[model samples]
Target: MSGLAKRLAGQTAIYGVSSIVGRVLNFLLTPLYTGRFAPAAFGIITGLFAYMSFLNVVFTYGMETTYLRFANRPGTNRRDLYNRVLTLLLLSSFGLTALLIALAPTLMRLLGIPPGSERYAVWLTLILGLDAVAAIPFARLRLENKAVKFASIRMANIVLNVGLNLFFLVLCPDVLAGKYLSGLAPLLRPLYNPSIGVGYVFLSNLAASAFTLLLLGRELLDFRPRLQVTYLGPLWRYAYPIMLMGLAGMVNETLDRVLLARWLPEGFYPGRSSLAAVGIYGACYKLAILMSLVIQAFKYAAEPFFFAQSEDKNSPRTFALVLKWFTISCTILFVAVSVNIDLIAPRFLTSPEYLEGLPVVPVLLLANLFLGVYYNLSVWFKLTDKTYFGTYISFGGAALTIALNFALIPVLGYMGSAIATLVCYVTMAVVCWLLGERHFPVPYPMSRLLLWLLAAVAVVAGSWALPPLGSWIAHMVHLLITLAFVAAVWLVERPERAFRRTQAKAA
Candidate 1:
C-alpha cells in the first residue's frame, strides 16, 4: 500500500481496536437486557435511545465537523478557532440542557413514559450536554493524530459503563433474588430497587458520562476561552446545513422505530402491542452492530484523514482506493452477520420473543453497509463546501423513510421499517454519487463496488443451500466462504497495480 493509505489504515485499525473491544463488551448487554426486560419494557429503552440519537445531533449542532474543517484550512488561527467553538458549544450545550431539564416532565409524558420516569429525561440531557462539549476535544485528538489517547479514553468509558451495568442489571438483581448472595441480600436490597428496573440502566450511563467528562476535563480546560460574534456568522453558515443533515440522517436511521410504534394501526396485532413489536425489531437490530461499529470507526479516522490530504495531487486516487477497500470490508461483514445470524440470534442476542423479528437482520445489515458508503461519498460535500447538498439528500431520504413506515407498518410491521431503511440508504447513496459526479467527481469505481455488494449477497444466500451438516462443518463452510471473498478481492482489485500506477505517474 502507498504511505497515505497505509497511514490511514493504521489509524483506522488503532481506532477500530478500541471500538471493537468496547462494542463487544457492551454488545454483551443485548442478551442481558433481552433476558431481563419484557418486550414492551425493552421497547421503551430502544425508543429513548432512538430519540437520544436525534437529540445528540441537535446538541452538538455539527460543531465537531466544523472545528475539523476550519482547523486545517490555510492562514487560520487554530487556537482562536478552537476557543470560539469550545465556548459556543459549552453555552449551547448547557443552555439546551436547562431547557430539556425544565421540560423533562412534559417531555416524559409526550414520550409515553410514566411521571416518575422524568429522571430518564434529565439523565439523557446531562449525557448529551457533556458529550457535546467533549466532542470537540475528541475531534482535536483525531486531527492531532492522537489515536492512542483517543482509544484509551473510549475504552475506559466502555469498561466503566459495562462494569456498572453488570452491577446494576446482573449482580444486584441476582443478590436481591436471594438465589446466590443470600448473606449480602439484606445489605444490598435497599440499594437495588426492583422497581427501578430500566432506571438502573439509565443511571449507570449517567455515571459513565460524568466520569468521561472528568477524564477529559484537562482537554476541556486547556483551550483559551474566547468568543467573537463576527466569526459566528461563517461558522453557523457552514454548520447549520450539516446540523440539519445530521438531524435528517438521524430521522432516517432512528425515526423508523418511532414510526414503527406510532404508525401501527390500533388493532395491528391481536395479542402483541406496538411497543412489543419495537422491542423485537430493536433486538434484531443488535445483530447488525458489527456493521455500525466498523462504520463508526472508519468515520472517526476518515474525516481527518481525508481533509489532511485534500490538497494532494493524488488524493482522488487515494479516495478511490479507500472506497474499494472499505466496500470490500463492509461486504465481508455483511456475509459474516447474515450467515451466522441464525446461531447468533438464538444463543446470545436475545430471547425467543425477539427471534420473531430476525428476518429484518439482513435488511438492516445491508442498510448499514450502504449507510457507510454514503458517509464516504459525503466527503465531497464537506470538501466542496456544498454541505447544503447533504441537507437536501438526508431530508429527501428522511421523507421517504417516514412515508414508507407510515404506509407499510400497518401491513408488514417492523419488516416495513426495515424495507424503508434499505430504500432510503440506497436512494441517498445514488443521489449523492450522481451529484458528486457533476460537482466534485471522485472516480469511485462504482462498477466494482456493485460487484462486491452483489457477490456478498450471493455468497450469503448460497450458504443456506449447504446441507444440514454439523455445526462445526457449517462454521467451516462459512470460514471457507469468507476466505474466498478475500481471494476474490486480491485478484480483482490488484493491490499492487495501484501502487505501481501511482509510482509510475509520480516518477
Candidate 2:
C-alpha cells in the first residue's frame, strides 16, 4: 500500500476500534433483548429506533461534513469555524428537541405507538439533541487527526451503555424477582422500576450520550456562540443539500422498519403479527452490522483524508484504488458471514423466533456493501462542490425504497424490505458513478469490481448447494471456500506487482 493508503488504513483501524468493536459490543445487546422480549415487544424498540435514526439526521443537519470541509480551507480559522458550527447546531437541536417533545404524543399516535409510550419519543429527542451538540466536537477530532482520543471516548461510551444495559435488564430484574443477588434487592428496588421495561435501553443510550458530551469538555471550551451572516450564509448553502441527502438516505436505510409494521397486511405471516415481523427483521438486521461498521469507520477516516488529498494530481487514481480495495474487503466479509450465518446467527440472536429472518442477512450485507461503495463514489460530488447531485441521487433512492417496500412488504414480509434495501443502494451507487464520471471522472475498475462481487455471490451459492454434512465438516468446508476465494483474489490481483508499478510511476 502507498503511504496515503497506509495512513487511511491506520486511521480506519483506530476508528474501527470504536466503530466495529464498540458496535459489536452494542450488537451483543440484541441477543439479550431478543431472549428477554417477545418478538412483538421487541418490535417497539425496533420501530422507535428507526424513527430515531431519521430524527438524528435532521438534528445533525450535515454540519459534520460542512465543518470538515470549511475547516480544512487555507486561511480559515479552525477554532472560529468550530464555534460557529457548534453554536448553530446547539441552537437548532434545542429548538427541534422542544418541538419534538411537544409533539411527541401526536407523533406516537401517528406511528401507532401506545398512548403512554410518548416517553420513548421524548427520551429519543433528548438523545438526538445531545448527540447533535457533540457532533462537531467529534468532527473537530477527525479534522485534527485525534483518532486515538476519538476512539477512546467512543469506546468508553459504548462500554458504559452496555454495562448499564446489563445492570438494568439483567441484574436488576433478577434481583427484583429474587433470582439472584437477593441481598441487593433493597438497594436496587427504588432505583429500578420494573414498569420501565425496555425504557432502560433509551435511558442507557441517553446517559452514554451525555457522558460523551461531558468527556468532550475540552473541545467545547471555546464555544462563544458566534453566528455572523458572513459565516452562516456559505455554511448554510453548502450544508443544506447534504442535509437533504442525509434525510433521504435515512429514508432508504431506516424507513423500512418504520413502515413494515404499518404496511404489512393482517395475517400475512399466519401466526406472526406485523410487529413480530418487524422485531424479527430488526434482529436479523443486526447481522449486517459488520458491513455497516466497516463503512462507518472508512467514512470517519476517508472524509478528512479525501479533503486533504483533493489538490493532489494523483488523487483520482488513489480514489480508484481505495474503492477497489474497499469493495474487495467488503465482498470477502459478505461471503464469509453469509456462508457461516447458520453458525453465527444462533449465537447472536439467542432466540429461535428470529431464525426466520436469516434469509435477509446476505441480501442486507450486499446492500450495505453497495452503500459503502456509494459513500466512496460520493467523494467526487463532495470535492467538486456538486453535493446537490447527492441530494438528487439519495432522494431517488428513497423513492424507490418507499415504493418497493409498499409493494412487496404485504406479500413477502421482511424479506421484501431487505430486497428493497439492496435495490435502493445498488441504484444509488450506479447513478452516482455515472454522474461522477461526467463531472469528476475517476478510473474505477468497474469490470474488476463486478468480477469480485460475482465471484463472491457464486461462492455463497455453491456453499448452499453442497450436500448436508456433520457440523465440523461443514465448518471445514466453509472455511476452505472462504480461503480459496481470498487466495484467488490475491493471485489474480497480484497486489505486490501493482504496488511496484505504482512505486515506479511515482519515482
Candidate 3:
C-alpha cells in the first residue's frame, strides 16, 4: 500500500473502534429511553436535536474544513492558525448561545413549540455551543493526526453520557421508589412519575455536555485569543458557501422528523402521535445510522489525510482504491443491517407500535450508505479547492428533500419522509460522482463494486421470499445470509491468501 492508503487504513481502524463502541454504548440507551419516555417525549428529544444539528453547522460556519486547509499550507504557523480559529469559534459560539437563550421563548413560539417549551431550546442551545467550542480541539486533533486522542475523547464522552443516563433513568428512579420516596415526598414528589420519560434523558445529556466541557479545559486554556481580521475575508469566502452547503446537508438529513411533527395525521394518538412517531423513527434511525457514524469517524480523519495526499503522484490511484474498498464494505454493511433488522430493530425499541419502522430501516440504511459514499467521493472538490461544488450539490439535494417532503408527507407521512431521505442521498451521490469526474477524476472500480453490492442485495431479497420464522430463527437466517455475503467477498478479493504470502516472506 502507498503511504496515504496505509494511513487511511490505520486511521480507519482507530476511528472504527471508537465509533463502533460509542454507537454501541449509545445504542444501549435507546431501549431505556423508549421504555421510559412517552413517544411525545421522544418527539421533543428528536426535534431539539434536529434544531441543534442545524445550529451546530452554523456555529462552526465551515471553520473545521478551513482549519484543515490552512494547517496544510506552507510555513503557515499552524498553531497560530489554530489559536485564531479556536478563539473566533469560542467567542462566537458563547455569544450565540447567550443570544439564543435570551430569545428562546420567542424562537420556541415561532417554531410552533409551546411558549414555555423553551426549556428544551435552552438546553440544546448551551449544549450545541459547548459542542461548537469543543469542535476546534477536536479538529486540531485531526490536523495533528492524533487519532487515538480523538477516539479516546469521543469514547470517554459516550461512557460518561451513558453512565449518567443509566443513573438518572434507572438507579435514581429505583432509589427514590424504594428508600427515599416517603422522606422526599414533600419536596421531590414530582420526580417519581413513571411517565416523565424523555425529560430525564435530555437532563442526562446536559449533564454529560457539562462534563465533556470540563474535560476539555486543558486544551481550551492552551489557546490564546488572536482574531486575525485579515484572515476573515478569505475564510468567509471559503467557509460561507460551505456553511450554506452544511445547512442544506443537515436539512436533507434531518428535516424529515421536523416536517413529520407537523404532517402526521390526527387520530394517531391522544395528543402525542408525532412524539411517538419521532421516538420510533429516531430509535430505528439510530440503528441505520450506526454505519453512518462509523463512516463519520473515518471521514473525520480521512478528509485531512486526503487533502495532504493530493500533492503526491500516486494519490489518484490510492484514492480510487480506498473508495472501492469503502463502497464494498459499506454495501456489505447495508446488507447485514437489512437482512438482520428483524433482530436488531427490537434491541432499540421493542414496542410493537415502533416496529412499524422496521420496513423503513432498510431504506434508511441504504440512504446512509449512499451518504457515506458521497462523503468519501467528496474529497475531489476539497482537493481541487473548488468547494463551491459542495454548495451546488448539497443545495440540489436539499431542494429534492424539501419538495419530496412537502409532496409526500401529507400522503404517506413518516414513510414518505424515509423515502424522501433515500431519494435525496442517492441523487446527491450520483451528482457528486458525475461532477467530480469533470475536475478531479479517479479510477473507481465501478464493475466489481456493483457486483458486490448486487450480491448483498440479492441475498436479502431472496431471504424475504422465505416464510417468516420465529425471531431467533429469523436472526440466524439473516446472520447466515450476511456471512455468506462476507465469504463471497473474501473469495473474490483473495485478501487472506495474499496476506499469508506476505507474512511467510517476512518470517
Candidate 4:
C-alpha cells in the first residue's frame, strides 16, 4: 500500500478500536434487550430510534462535513471555522430540541407512543441535542487527526451507556424484585421504576450523550461562539444540501423501520402484531452491524483523508484502489457473517421468536455493502463542490425506498422491508458511480468488484445448501468455506505484487 493508503488504514484501525469495540458492546445489548423485552416492546425501541435517526440529521444539519470541507482549504482559519460551525449547530440544536420537547405530547401521539410516556420523546430529544452539540468537536478531532482522543471519548461513552443500561434494566429491576441483593433494594428503590419499563433505554442513551459532551470539555471550551456572515453564507449553502441529502439518506436507511408498523397489513404474520414484526426485523438488522461497523470506521478516516488528498494529482487512482480494497473487506465480512449466522443468531437473540427474521440478515448485510460503496463514490461530489447532486440522488433513493416498502411490506412482511433496503442502496450506489464517471472519472474496477460480490453471495447460498449435520460439524464446514474464500481473495488481490509492479513502473 502507498503511504496515503497506509495512513488511511492506520487511522481506520484507530477509529475501529472504538467503533468496533464500542459498537460490539452496544451490539451485545441485543441479547439483553431481547431477553428482557418481547418483540412488540422491542419494536417500540426500534421505531423510536428510526425517527431519532431522522431528527439527528436535522439537528446537526450537516455542519460536520462542512467543517471538514472548509477547514482543509488553503489559508482557511481552522479555529474560526470550527467556532462558527459549532455555534451554528449549538444554536440550532437547542432550538430544535426545545421545539421537540414542547411538542412532546403531539409527537408522542403521532409516533403511536402510549399516552403518559412523553418521557420517551423528551429523553430522545435531549439525546439528539447533546449529540448534535458534540458533533463539531468530534469532527474537529477528525480534522486534526486526533484519532486516539476521538476513540477514547467514544469508548468512554459506549462503556457508560452499556454500564447504565445494565444498571437500570437489569440490576435495579432485579434488586427491586428481591431476585437477589434484596438488601440493596431499599437503596435502589428511588431509581427503580417498573412503570418506566423500556423508557430506561432512552434514559440510558440520554445520560451517555451528556457524558460524551462532558468528556469533550476541552474541545467545547475552545469555542468562542463566532458567526461571521462571510463564512456562514458559504457554509450554509454547502451544508444545507448535505443536510437534505442526509435526511433523504436516512429515509433510505431507516424509513423502513419507521413505516413497517403502520404499513404492514393486519394478519400478515399470523399471531404476530405489526410491532412484533418490526421487532423481529430490528433484531435481525443488528446482525448486519459488522458490515456497518467496518463502513463506519472507514468513513471516519476516509472523509477527512479524502478531503486532504483532493489536491493531489494521483487522487483518482488512489480513490479507485481504496474502493477496491474496501469492497474486498466488506465482501469478506458479508460471507463470514452470513455463513455462520445460524450459530451467531441463536447466541445473540436468545429468544426463538427473533430467529424467524434471520433470513433478512444477509440481505441487509449486502445492502450495507452497497451503502459503503455509495459513501466512497460520494467523495467526487463533495470534492467537486457539487453536493446538490447528492441531494438529488438521495431523495430519489428515498422515493424508491418508500414506494418499495409500501408495495412489498404487506405482501412479504418484514422481508419486504429488507429487500427494499437492498434495492434502494444498490440503486443509489450505481447512480452515484455513473454520475461520478462523467464528473470525476475514477477508474473503479467495477467488473472485478461485482464478480467478488457475486462470488461471496454464491458462497453464502452454497452454505445454505449443505446437508444438515451436527452443530459442531456444521460449524466446521462453514469455517472451512470462510477460510477458503479469504484465501482466494488474498491470492487474487496480492498487495505485495501490486506494490512491486508500481515500483517497477516508477523505476
Question: Backbone clashes per model, in order?
Answer: 0, 0, 2, 0
The runs of at least 3 residues in candidate 2 whose Cα sits more than 4 Å from the true structure, single-residue gaps closed, are: 501-507
Worst 10 residues of 2 by lDDT: 497-506
For model 2 the TM-score comes to: 0.98
Ranking by lDDT: 4, 2, 1, 3
Question: Which has the higher lDDT value, candidate number 1 or candidate number 4?
Answer: 4
lDDT of 2 at 339: 91
- Per-residue lDDT tens digits for candidate 2, residues 366-436, read 99999999999999999998899999999999999999999989889889999999999999999999999
The alpha-carbon lDDT assigned to residue 7 of candidate 2 equals 93
User: Can you tell me which runs of candidate 4 are displaced by over 4 Å?
Assistant: 501-507
Alpha-carbon lDDT of model 4: 0.93
Q: Estimate each model's TM-score.
A: 0.95, 0.98, 0.92, 0.98
Best lDDT goes to which candidate? 4
Writing each residue's lDDT as its tens digit, candidate 4 over 330-418 gives 99999999999888999999899999999899999999999999999999999999999999999999999999999999889889999
Itemize residue pairs with steric clashes in candidate 4: none
